[model samples]
Structures are given as C-alpha cells and as structure tokens.
Target chain A: MTALAIGIIIGCCALGAGIAMIAGIGPGIGEGYAVGKACEAIGRQPEAKGAVTSTMIMGCAIAETTGIYALVIAILLIFVAPGRFVDILTKAVRQIP
Target chain B: MQNSIQSRNPDRTTAKKPNKFVDFLLVLMMILPFAGCIALKVLFGNPGKGINVTGAQIYFTVKMPLQDMYITEGTAVSAAVVIALFALVLLLTRGLRRDPDTKRQLVAEFIVEKCDAFVEDNMGRGFLGFSPFVAAVMALSAFSSLSSLLGLYPPTSDISIVAGWAVVSFSLITFYKLRGGAWNYFRGFFEPIPLFAPMNVISELSTPVSMAFRHYGNVLSGYVVSTLVAAGLSSVSAALLRMLPGAIASFPLLRIGIPAVLSIYFDVFSGIMQAFIFAVLTILNVKNGFPEEEYERRMRKKQARRLEREGKKRPEREKNAA
Candidate 1:
C-alpha cells in the first residue's frame, strides 16, 4: 500500500506536468490571434504595422504569463516541492517532541 | 474573400505541393538533438545525473555537439564557459547594433511600442518618463525566455539576474526622484508619516530586495522541480527494470510520452511566463511616479467636460455659423 501511494504520487506528478502544458495552449491561441490581428491591421493600414505589431507582441507576452505560472507549478511538483523532504523533517521533529 | 486568396493567386499556372521532405527535415532538425540525448540517456547512462565535478555534486549540466559536461560548482569549466560565451555573444551583438542606423531605428520603434503599451496599462499615460527602463526590462526578459526555449538555462531563474535588474530599477527610482524635484522626492518619503520614518525607510529600501526574491522564488522553484522529476523518473525506470524485468520493459513507452509533454511545460511555458512577469513587475514599479500627477491632470479634464456640458448652448452658435 505504501508503494502504491508512492506510485500514485509519481503518476499524479506526471499528469500535472502534462496538464501544465495545456495552459500553454491559451498563449498559443492568444499569440496566433494577436498575429492575425496585426496582419489584418497592417493590410488595412500599412503605416500602422509598426504600432500594431508592437501591441500584438506586448499582449502576447502578457497572455504567455499564465502558461509560465503553470510551468512553474509543474516544476515545483516535480523537483523542489520539498514534499518528501518536508515529511522527513516533520517526522524528525515529531520524534524529538 | 480570405478563402478565395489562394484561388486568386496570379502565378497559379501550376499548382505545386509543399516539399514534405524539407518540412520533415525542419521538424527533425528541431527534435533530433534533444531526442538523441534522451535516447542515449536511456540506452547507456546519462552522465548528467548528479555529476561529481571536482568532488562536489552540481545541479547543472551542459551539452556540447558531441559530449555532455556537468558542472557542480560556479567555478566549473563547463557552466562557466557556457555562461561566459552567452554573455560575450550578447554583448558583441548589442555592440554591433549600437549605432542608430535605419534597422536599429525600426527595432527601437518596436521596443518603444511595447514599452508604451506596458506602461499605459500598468501606470497609465505617465509611462513616457520611464520608457527607457521599460524597454530594457522587456528586451532582457524576452531574450532570456526565448533562450530557455532553445534549451539553455534561463538567466531569469538565476538570483543574481533578478538582483541586477532590481539594482537598476532602484537606481532609476532615485534618479527620477532627483530629476522630478529633489526636495519633494526626499520629503515625499516622509510626508505621509513622520514618527515611523525609520520603519518606512527600511520598508522602502527593501522593496527592490522583495522584488528580486519574488521573481527568484517563482523561477527557481520551477527549475528545481523539472530537474528532479526528470531524474526521479529515470531512476524509477531503472529500479523497476532490476526488480521485475518483464513487466517494466514496457514501461519506457508509457514514461517517455508523458514526461516529454511535461518538459515542454516546465522548460518552455513556465520559463517564458516568469520572464514576462519579471519585466511587467519592473515596469509597474517604475510607473508609480505618474499616478499622482496624471490623476490631477485627468481630474481637470473632467471638470472641463462638466463646464462644457453646462455651457451646452455654445454648440447652437457654431451650428448657426456653419
């Protein structure tokens, strides 16, 4: 059962990492949308392409932020959560008490 | 009209199929290097796992064209060389484009536009004064994040990187204060409260530190997590093979696909987001300058609108003249 629990934790972590990439889908769609808008604006007003492209890039950058947050969470789950480490620490503290 | 664009092509004398071979080669080029490394890790052993460099275990590794080098400390040749090369390349590239030629101006314009929008959204119209800082922050973050996607450690995840930006940001604030009016700026620090000045000052002084830590915490956490997962999975696969050879031989197929997806998120998605957040936070911090002044200016415009509405009869005179 202890082994099962460990397996489950690892499996969940693997799933979390994959799910985190799904967050990137938003930015992917958003960046594509931004580019499409920039292209359309450039076609309509060629002179404004500079302004349009810049705005698009900025918006895309912001939209990309959410995906980053997801990535960070995914990474934390895998590497630095201090999960088992913390558990060990707590057990040590409890033993002392 | 958009759907008919291909049909309306003037040079449609012969319909041509896209060269699938070239397209496949491009895809292969992007994947082959990383795929080869992973394959080698599974087949033999990835020497990168907790590499012992000069008697110390280091968390970082670098891949050259043929060999992989692990660096356990800041002094290690592998990490130091790569970082130095990256910095030198960056500096040389910047130096090459230092002159205000036609191409530079176009790049500058794009940078200006991004800066303007960032400031306007976060700090409103008063963003013009700190435009240079905004441009610098955005450019740095973008380059760092883009490099992370290309399979290099994002410098943004480094504590020193955050500290460097924080120092620059704090310096800009001081400079802006001096330029805007030294007396008001210095006194403004104590204007809202006099008795708790020391605590306020300390808090204000620590703002940059806090900013740096916030960014470092988020990015460092992600970097550590991804590395652990990758290592942990590799070990688990190895152990399972030793324990029950038959049942877990099929496990490799299950493991690779799942973790590859995770790597894309950890390495690409999170890296880019953290970079943007760091830049945005910097821009937001610099933007506090214009709020008080811009609010007053906007208030005056509102008052003028009210007066114009009260004097609504003036439009009739203009209409009669026309």
Candidate 2:
C-alpha cells in the first residue's frame, strides 16, 4: 500500500472519531433540557421532590445512551478500524503480487 | 423517662453485641476481597504503564463445540462474593422468634419491611410479592459496583452483567404484558393506526437495550474516569517530585491521597445511584407493561378478599391499597 493511502486511512479514522463525538452535543442539550424541566417541576411542587428527582434521573440516563453509543463507535474507530484498513490493504497488495 | 423506657425494654437496651466470631468473620469477608486482589496483582497481573479503561479481564477460556467461552475475572469473583454475603445474611437471620431476641433479627426484618414498603410505594400494593426480587436486584447491583472501591473488579462494569439483568427484566415486562392478554398485547403494537407499527416495535425493543446501555455506560464511565484521574495524578506528581531525593521522587505521593476523594463520587455515589436507577426502571417498566384495566381488576379481587376478612365497610387506607 502507498504511504498516502495509509495516511488517508489513518486521517479518516481520526476524523470519524472526532465527528462521532459530536453526537455528545445532542445528549448534553437534551439532558440539560430535561433537568431544567425537572427543576421547574420540583419548584412547583416541592413535596414531589423525590418523585421528580428519580424520574428526571431515569430520563437523563436514557438520554445519555445516545452519547454512549457515540462513544462506543468512536472507540471502535480509534482502536479497531484503523488496523483493519491497514490489514486489508496489505492483504490485497500481497494477493496482487 | 428515657431510662425508664430503656428499663422497660431490657432486651433492646441490653442487646448483646454480635458474637465475637461473627464480627471477626464479617471483617474477614470485607478484607478478603481486597487481599485477594492485591495478591493476584502481585503474582499474575501486568497492568502496564498507562490507564486501563477496558472491560472485564479475561481470566481463562473454555473450549466449546462451536465457539470458546471466555470467563472474566470480575463476574466470577463478584458473583461468589455477593452470593456468600447473601448466604451469610440468611444464616444470621435463621431461627427467628416472634419477638426479636437479637439486633440481627431486627435488622433483617427492617430490611425486608423496607423493601416491601419501597415496592408497594413505587409499583402499587399488587406488587408486594415482588419485593424480594426487587431487593435482590438492588443488592446485587449495589454490591457489584461498590466492590470496585475495594480494588476488586466491578462486575457491572462489564456490559454482559447489566445486559443479562436487563434481559431478565425485559422478559418479565413481556410476561406481564402477556398476562394482560396476548391478543391485546400483540394488537396494541399497531395502535391508533397500522403505519405506526414499526415505530412501536422499535420503541418496545429499545427498552432493554437502552436500560442496559444506560446503566453499563454510567458505571463504566465512572470507572474509566477514576482510572484516568489516578494515572494523571501519578504522572503530575512524578513530574513535580522529580527534583526531590531518590525514594520520595519515585513514590506516587499524590496518588496516595487524591483518588479517594474522587472515588467517593465515581465509585460510591455513582455505583449506588446507578443501582437505584436500575431498580426504579425495572419496577416502573414491569408495572407499566401490564394493562391498567387488568391491574384494576386484579386489585379489585384482592380488595374484595380483604373486605370479606374484615367484615366491615373497608377503611380509607384499604381503598388506596388498590
């Protein structure tokens, strides 16, 4: 494989991981919105504090799953994908020769 | 008056200290996991010079027909420890009398009653029978996560452990829905219109996966952050202390005292909160799965049976029990 091809694969993997992490923005904003509403709810009915807090927590955790999924994908890109590209490219080169 | 009260209940005032041997055994149980971990680290572990943010360490692999089975260090050890802890609690609570003679019995009863009350409050009185199962899940999840504080590998840090529990809860949710009525349960997926069926199916399927990932991610992230912090601190300390004399320079001075503070949140707080969230989610999911009408019908039968026993106009509290 040419050096440029290897560099491009590595660069793309880096770019992909960085892009995948942008998925965190959605969860962050969503969770913040949920927490903001929950705060308003608890303020409106202080007696319902425990219920509101728990419900808010569950909602936030669910919201966080999207970011976690992104983290998993980014992890794969960094640790697994780059090596695969190189391995496949080298194998193809050997077969051609 | 306080003295009089104490005299009236001599057993409560003068309850014997737990047996010496039992106390020793309890301490031993707490210490054993940490000691075993340290010993293993000394003997067979190779934690290289970097932060270890990974899943359960594969302790061994067993041959299988189609594929090999990899056993992890975390799941096996934590499972044994948690089971043994449960057994020990059970053995201590054995042979209880009508009136509590020992504080141990009182404590055990307190736990059981509290578990029942939590279930009743959250999932309604119809779920009183589920209190034991709820308590078991809470205890298992909490213990597994808290084990990381002792330097033992946390079982819940591995996705498989949480995923297994999530799957169990998912099936229980399905079972409750089935009990409501098979036809209705299946047909409800098409609800309000047929075009929405695929969306409904996806939503239904997301429940378990979301639960598992939410929990596993939180706990694993906490573990990873704690590890990174410890490593970072060590490096920062080493850089600072390099100018010092030999032994002091080599030692990780910052690592000794700093990680414990972060650990309070990462290990203790996050562990407990995740366990609680998991339990609450399980209870809510199961409760919601059953049809509301079916629940009302079952509750009415229970109330009717209670009314027969009481032989009077049912009390206000009894009405709310529905």
Candidate 3:
C-alpha cells in the first residue's frame, strides 16, 4: 500500500512539474519579440548595432528570470518536495500498523 | 623590451619561444588534478554509488547570535582553487612591459583593454573606474560556475554564494544613489504618487532577490539536469550492454563521451554567458541609480556659489595648493 501511495505522489509531482514548465512559453515568446524588434532597429541603423545588441541582451537576461523561476519550481517538485512527502507517508503507514 | 608604447607589438623576435615552458605548464595542469583525484579516491574509498543531488556539502558550522554559518565543501575547495588560479595568473603577468613584447603581456593587456572599453561603452565614460570591480565579479562568477567541469559542485549553483554577490551589487546601487543627494534618494520612493512608496520599496528589495534567484536557478538547474542525464545514461547503458557478451557487458561505454557534448553548452557557454549578463546588469543598475548629469550640475553650481563667497580671489586649485 505504501509503495502504491509513493508512486501516485511522484506521478502527481511529475504532472505539476510539467504544468510549471508552461511558464517558459511566456518568456520564450517575449524574448523572441524583443529580439525581432531589436533586429529591425539594427537593420534601420547598422551603426547602432553595438548599442542595440547590448541593450537587447540585458533585456533578455531580465526576461529570462521568469522561465528560470519555472525551472526552479519544477526542480524543487521533482527532487526536493517529493522526498518530504514520501517520508511523511512512510511514517504514517508505519504508525498505523 | 627597449621599444616604446608607440611601437606596438614591436619586434616579435623579442618573444623567446616558451614552447617547452607551455608544454610543461600544460602537463602540470593535467597531472595535478589527476593526482588529486587519485589521492581523493585513496582517502575516501570510492565515490558515492549513485548520483547525489544536493547543494554544496556542509563541512561544519559556526554559531553566531543571529544565525549559524555553515561552511560547505564548495566554499572551501572551490575558493582555494580560484585563489590559486588568480595567483598563477597574476604571477604570469607580473613582469609585463608597457610595449607588450611577451604573449603573457598581450593577454593581460587584451583583458584590461576589453574590460575598460566594455564598461566605458555600456555605462558611459564617467564610470570607467568601475571596470575592475565588474571584471572581478565576472571572473569570480564565471570561474565558480566553470568549476563544475572539474566534477566538483559549483559554488554558483548555491544560492548563498550568488546572493552574497547580489547583495553587494545592491549595496553599491544604494551607495551610488545616495551620491546624488539624500533628499533625492528618499524622494524617489514617492515618485508619481506618495501612495506608490510601498511598491517602490518592495521593488527595490526585490531587485537583489530576483538577481540572486536568476543566477542561482540557472546554474542549479543546469547542474541538476546534467546530473540526472549522467545517472540516467549509466543505468540505460548498463541495461543495454547486458545483452552483449561477457566482458563487454560490464562496461558502460555510452557514459564516456556523450556527456561532454552536453557539458559544452551547460557548463562552458551558460557559465560565461551568465557571468557577462550579471556584470552588465550590475553596471547598468548602478549607473542608473543616480542622475549623473544632474549630480555634476549640482556640484558645479555649489562650487560656483563657493567661488562667489570667496570673491574669486585665490581660484579653486590655488587655494587647495596653498
């Protein structure tokens, strides 16, 4: 029964982690749009390429934080949070016997 | 050696062929780490049987009134390696001439010149003095992250290490903002409307938090993903190889060269890219903290008022000289 319980908990966590990764879509789109605009601007004024590239990189780095946040959440769900729940589940099962 | 700075790269023949010296150093670099690994294995028996996914291993703890500080393996080992590398680089570039005869001097000059120009172009001419601090931070971050390539836990993957640097950056931002004026610094919180002060304050605090988390998350996720992939590959290779004949079945050949390609992107590219981005963000944030032109104008106006008070008799520099 405990083995069955642990499997279900981990499966749920996998689902949550998958859902959390949807945050990547937002930043991926935003960054692509920003870069597209930056490319257009650079094309119009090639001399400003250095400034444009630097600014775009800085902006993208900031935008990337949200996607990174999602990744962190997913990592936590997969690696860290499951262990605690498993421990608790095991302890509860042992006490009931 | 006799050439002036104007005679740039003067007489390439002055560079004595350090071919043997380069070979010797390269050999030392390889052998030292390999020997250390052997010594570590002898001391600790074998490595843990399976993958261990945790932050830097806490070696010991120091108690304080407020909080206990735990010094981890990453802090001790990686820090020592970083300092040794810094010393080695410093020693190499020690006798560098202004005219740049040796390859060592050229490397040193190239780094300094690039950093100076990068800072100057990004943050304007007035912030040129900040190049050293920015470069140092970048070097520390890049090196710390790259330490993972040595099969050690990277310090950058730990939030505490990255947060410490982020806090320093935040403090520098605050210090620069105060340079404008105490009034302007305090007044900024109430910009647009006084009701927005709380939001501004929260945003101000979140800057460091966000920066710290961004770096920490990026490095940690990469490290974690790579660890998972390696462990997965070992098991899969074992399962696959089991069908083969006796001796060959035992070897996990798939684990050999495959991970190196993945590491090129995760360890090398991401490490350097994140360091560059962090340095750029730090510079830009600090530069934007104060109104540079307004501060200069205010200082000039104050100086003019002082001159008027002194009846313009002695002049500014003469009075200081006197």
The DockQ figures for the candidates are 0.06, 0.44, 0.70
After superposition, candidate 1 runs with Cα above 4 Å error: A1-97, B1-112, B124-126, B243-257, B290-322
The local distance difference test score of each candidate is 0.57, 0.79, 0.81
Model 1 earns a TM-score of 0.45
Candidate 2 stretches with Cα past 4 Å from truth are: A1-10, A38-51, A79-94, B1-38, B245-248, B292-322
Best by DockQ, which number?
A: 3
DockQ of prediction 3: 0.70
Better of 1 and 3 by TM-score: 3
In model 2, the clashing pairs are none
Residue B209 CA displacement from its true place in model 2, Å? 0.7
Candidate 2 per-residue lDDT over residues B1-322, each given as its tens digit: 2243345455544544556676667667656765776566456566654566556667779999999988776766566567556665755565354456767767777888788889988999888888878888888888888878778678887788889999999998899888766788989899989999999999999999988887777777677677888889988989999999978997888899788998788788888888888888889988888798975676677778888798968777767965
On lDDT, the stronger of 1 and 3 is 3
Q: For residue B7, what is the lDDT in candidate 3? A: 57
Interface CA RMSD of each prediction in angstroms: 7.1, 2.2, 1.3
Docking class of 3: medium
In candidate 2, the second chain superimposes onto the true chain B with a TM-score of 0.81
lDDT for position A2 in model 2: 73
lDDT of 2 by residue, A15-76 (tens): 99999999999999999999999999999999999999988887887677899888767766
User: Between which residue pairs do clashes occur in model 3?
Assistant: none
